[model samples]
Target: MTKTIPNYLRIHRGIDRQDSTNREQSQNLITSFWNSYSDATGWRIDSRASRKNNVLELLPAVTSETPQDHSDEFTPVVGRIAATRLATAASNLTEQVLRTRECLRQREAELASSAAMIGVEHDGKVSADQIEQSLADAMEACKCDAAALYMLDEDTRYLKARSVVGLPIERLENPPRELRGSRGDLEAMVQDVVTIDNMTAGSIDTWNSPEPFAAGICVAIKVDDIPIGTLWLFRETTTEFGSTESAIARLVATNLSLLLRQAPQAEIFDNPQPHQAIQEIAQWQYESLPVGSALAEGWRVDGMIESSESWATGWHHWDVLPDGTLMLAIAEATDPTATGAMHAAVARAALAAHSGYRHTPAQLIQRVSDTLWQTNTGEQLVSMTYAHLDPETGDGIVSSAGSISALISSRYGYRPLISSLSAPLNTSMDSNAANHEFHMLEGETLLAYSKGFATAGADQMTLGGHIRTAMQLEDRSPLAMLRRKLIDLPLTQERGALTLLRT
Candidate 1:
């Protein structure tokens, strides 16, 4: 053997040496990469990203509570005012802006006056007598023959009369909390205002106040995006609710809501300017109801959010484009105060303003980042999940910023998903960040949420377990499921938002 080594034996020895060299080199390279990468960026890209990520997109796991739409158009018309519609010229733009500004100023003044008239800003407490007097005052303030204030029952669905003024004697004697039976045409939770000149011909039974009522205006009163009650101004005459009239009624209704949300009947009886008043103002200022009419059919979205800070903003929104693309998004502010909420709202307004140039979530996030930076509001970071899901295929293109992720369930169990950590909508981050697309099989649903949910969540595992069961059920509802998981937490306040999307 020593005299003559065979060629096969010689080749095997060489291959073993080569394999050893390659292993040593690979180990050295990985070590150097980790050290250099962490030192340079202050973070490490997960090794798992190589396995889960495609070239550009990601799939997250989340839905609704419906978010308020942030459209710039405001009109103080018969029902509502378009907020800001740009004009052709800087001069014309200046004039139009002035016009809009004046309208809002007048509108706000009217609201403040009407709310103040209801004894909202009084130094003393609120009473049944005070509320009844306010209803009477509101009717007179709006120059209507009658007014009724229906507060949301604990169920937060049916509006029962908390106070009533100027109704038929019979209705006043036996006031029905429910204005009408089961509603399909209009979701009371989503609608802001309604005006009917003629009750019978309006085609909505809910709007028909009652017999002997010829016209009426109805307004929803909400706090922190949750509807608490409704204010209705009924007129025996056939006159319509003009723009001024509608705006006045809405202002009165809005402040009335603030009064209720701030002064529990007890607090109202105790103090006029409750500490919660400022927070309520901030929350309601930019936060509004989503334009449900713009959503596509067969899709329902719901969201639940709690803010620890008065300025903290949690929002959910969805809209349909000209070409049938459905976009849904939920956002949370990092600062957890009104300033943070304002940042989130500004980000949303920027997104809506440039919607013409953005179709996908990627483009939208990128544009939003740019807008924030350009507007100098990029200091406060906002975490968000924006996605487009095709109802036909149940496949979705999801773009995320910060700690947004998705979940999908298989027979084995629930799996958390995301390729890697992406930059939040910040001036410091790269605008060319990638988006991920998730293709789902039958029975798999997606959940999207702010990372804060993880921090606020009392039982993270229980939340997942509930969501898993919901996914497996034939008649699953994301709203009911999310409410169950997040409701009645040990913590008095939470700063997180959640949204769900289904096939």
Candidate 2:
């Protein structure tokens, strides 16, 4: 019998192959173009120049005194204009390249951070024994008679039992539960945790188990905020699950999710290729922050991303909607791996693509969450703040998920803008986000940032104080002042921030 490849494994292989091919083609094209250009110009290119400064050094500097009518030279005026234009273009390109490199470095740091957090070795394999042991521990900790782990199928249409204890595995596998409707498993996934007072009650969907159980509790298994499966525990008595049991169940489920994510990847590759994984992740391009700033009649928006020497995943985006409303968003991923960056990218793209639809801040956030769920990449959690402001009136609405921070700063002082936050995107199937309305008067600024902005052990007040001090410097732009104030802080993690000043 031929061994069949799983759908997910095939998909990963195809993606990896395509990425490799694209990189090779890009390098070849660059080499060919440079060779042809050098031949045409009769300029011997410096092969030893550093990557950082090579682009500028490759172009010959134009001089004002060059002859205008010469077949090979330009007039003084023409030469000056060409030189100025070339300089400007080179400067912009160089800046963009530097920014891209910095972003890549930050993402690498995030991947390392994620690896440490998940406590998984670079070998990629997560053994079945480890998963079984986790389930046994959960059962012992929760004091449940039996437990079952149902993982989502490849298509995410059904939940299939992957591990079982104190129950017949064949019984649970007879018919996998479809992931639709208000079934116990689905409810647990949506609500995070569900408790059944009695298994015989209508609230529990037992699927007619052979062994009768009195009570049960189910907790959603999630990586990042995306639900991947459900963990069920059964009891012989109708004892309600308390906070301790619920917590232990959730913890076990969390560990299982991480292991599950790795198991498939390991099985598909069948080899220890840690370097390849890191390279592929590093080369995976995410959406870059919007270039420069945006300006309206009364509003000026400037954004900055300061990558940490440590782990950081942050992005900020701003665009002018068709109706002249300025849309702004800032997000941070909990895990600093490719999955986390992709989560931020998905949110950013959804926000930009749907801005023309005129969705409110809360609605926009819901759309991003929905996009993330649909993609099914649940390896990381993304916290975001979405806002839209009427430039003419400085009236705006802001909504946040997770704990992303938003503040308003003026001559009075800086204070928090988003008082409450909902669960992060992919955390739940439904949106619990709420929009907060605020008005910005002249000389007031609105600043939104990811957790990366705060150094470890620092409180909100300390972050606020830094912003207030940055605001006091009237001679510089808000973004510039903020960057200068906080860039030197000892950051063990990454930070991203966006600022809008009403002048």
Candidate 3:
């Protein structure tokens, strides 16, 4: 296919032109043609293109007064010779582009290698200083005389110079903030890569540079496409950056972004206070839930929970009455951020007191709610789902304190076991308690879960509806398979207890 590639729109333009020698050769050939037919032709090479059809045309820049004067004599031999030069020029420019791309790919692979090496170590691997050192090494590899690394503060939009070589601190401290009141050039952070040769004052803020400004490249350090900071490299001579230089800068920015992103983990690990606190809370959060096994005559019940850094859930102890009623409750604190172990413990005690054979699922939750009101359970509220099942008859009853609805799967169909939403635990006893009853066919399953389970691990409606449609009548794997799938989901950070009863 032919690209227009006018003389002005040629690939060999500015810094992108790689084959200066070939371009000069092509220009000489055109001049030679004008000299050969100088007196015979008013022909000049006016419009020109490095053609894609394996050919080149040196038209006579004149009226058709002498239309057939020179065509017969020179057209055949000149066309062949011109084709050779055209191919050479095109091939050279094409090679330049390919070379730039290959270099960038190699740089990316090198960055990945650096990341893998750092990933092997824990505490010292992702520190901010490590990032600065890595970036400095990258600067050396990129062959820049001077470079600086800037990282955004935890709460501030402006960037601060973290590390630098061959640059003054006063001028390089802040690049740009992409804000109105900020002092630096906003384009430095907003654009992909900005390069300027012979930079002056006010334009790029190179006015304060120690040596006379020459050339510079700036790129934003981005994570998941959002700019976090800027990386700058400067040269001492008047030379514009090419694609290869810009690409290397981008790759360096990417590596810096990843390192900065992981820096928080390093900080947490190096500081013993937050480290110990995280370990303790993580232990309490996971160990607080009973996920092993809950089995009785004609019932097989099991559950699991996974929490993010921000939220955790505690499940009430399972109840297996003498009548083979398998009861399970999953609870989440009203304030999603609070990891309220003591509050969950109090609610579990109340639930255990009434979860025996005498009380129905609705009645048991009602009693727990009343206890929360009367006792010193504080102003805390909890959302919970309590479900009890008689696996022998495939019969079950479910009650919720504004918890997620249960999912029922069988040969008939698979979907969320729809139920009415109700008040949470610690509500007034007078508030109505809603109950949902469900029956399962042979080899069917009933899965009850907390609010976190509904959304975190997967889309609530989509997962439930998929289970409903794909459920097998004789499947034995209850919630275990579902739990594993949930754990693999990116959004499953706050996934809570999931209890399943199989008939």
Candidate 4:
């Protein structure tokens, strides 16, 4: 093939000549012929090589003459050479395309397998132990003295330590740092990677780690373009991290992000024995149900709980205050074990205890937040909706935190009521809760539910449509109907909801 290329080029260069006036036109004509040939053959020849002293450049220039007039003594040789070059180019282009496709297929297969294995290992739930193990592995990979992973809370306002190795958890989470300020973690997240040569320079907030030494590297853990958390590697000596260390840290952070994205509801506490765990889970489930429905003048209130898991952390409550105000609450903890149930219980108790204070919905949420902080349970992820309603006028104010869903449905239609963004309860010391004021018209109802409702194949929009369809019927017990519909769906987690109807 190499010998033929040179011979072909030499023979083609000897037979082509045209006037300078027609030279440019001849070159364009030659280029057009090759381009047409390439299109017909579906081969992408290099344009630069084609323009150079190649076989295609030696074609006889076309003029105002017959086809036979352009044919020369070298016609047979030129035809043979062009055929050979086209055949070789086509083979090489096909081989290159196949190789590129194979590489892409291999990469896709690897990613798919990784995702499948992750799903199988965690079973859609990442535990505290798993995160801690990941931190330890990352520390070992980076050859660091300690490692830690800090994830944003529900509000994305503070970075809380999700897992730690070679450092006290309390020291890392004593006071969670804000996500907006000029800190090492924030810088790493914004800049992709950051290194700190001095730990006490105030640029990197170490939370005053005990026995902390000199240097550290912070790598942002993100899923796609969204920043989820930061991975930190600490060294005892003041040494800068090399490219290899930084790269390994990035890989570890990427894997951790996959786990985090897959399992947003992480178990943050130690797992008990299977038997003890089952028993505690059962106890939590039993205690999560509301005592009964609330009754007031011209008001109807009811709630339901459904779960297929061994434990569910959803609860509902309603109480009538001395001033004829109806207090309603629905909450679910993100933890999937007994710990989550305990957190939900704490939130429920806080709401019940403060119902008599005649506080507005926002004020009541703040008080509950304060209670959670005082009880040392403010760090847990809990979504809740608390409301205060006047039974006489059906006027109400509701506040939601985290992902709790709420809407108002009537004969007309249904629309979401909680649009304000707020972090889940206990996520922050200062709860920046927003209050949504609404008036429940006659024959209208308020529905508040947990994450399981959406996870069970029904989103707020779908549920609204369903409610609209159900309202067309003359059924007095719409809540029961909706509960039955939800029960029929495949269960993935705990589902809890409460409905307040003004008749």
Judging by lDDT against the true structure, name the best candidate.
Answer: 4
Alpha carbon lDDT at 128, candidate 4: 51
Clashes of each: 39, 4, 4, 0
Query: Against the hidden true structure, what lDDT does model 4 obtain?
Result: 0.67
Report lDDT per candidate.
Answer: 0.56, 0.65, 0.58, 0.67
- Please write out the lDDT profile of model 1 over residues 126-174, one tens digit for every residue: 4445555666777887778777665554444455444556653223334
Candidates ranked, most accurate by lDDT first? 4, 2, 3, 1
lDDT of 3 by residue, 76-178 (tens): 3234345446545654665685576445433432332233233244332334346547667766766667776555554445555555555533333235342
Q: Model 2: which ten-residue window has the lowest total lDDT?
A: 10-19
Model 2 residue 33 distance off true place after TM-score fit, in angstroms:
74
Total backbone collisions, model 1? 39
Worst 10-residue lDDT window, candidate 4:
8-17
Q: Which candidate has the top score in TM-score?
A: 3
Let me know the TM-score candidate 2 reaches against the reference structure.
0.43
Which regions of candidate 2 are displaced past 4 Å? 1-287, 308-312, 377-380, 419-421
How far residue 397's Cα lies from its native spot in candidate 3, in Å, is 2.8
Tens-digit lDDT track of model 4 for 1-503:
45546432332112122332332222343356555554444333443555433333233333333256544532332353565487567546756855764454333223322332432444344445556677788888777878876766656797765566776433442566777754777778788888776666555536343234466888887766767677788776555567888788878887777665444233323442357767776776677565545477767788877766666687888888788788888888878766887787778788778886657888888888888788873476678888888888888888888777788888789988874446887777877776788899877778887778777788888777666655667445667878766667887888888888777
Q: Where's the lowest-lDDT run of ten residues in candidate 1?
A: 79-88
When 1 and 4 are scored with TM-score, the better candidate is: 4
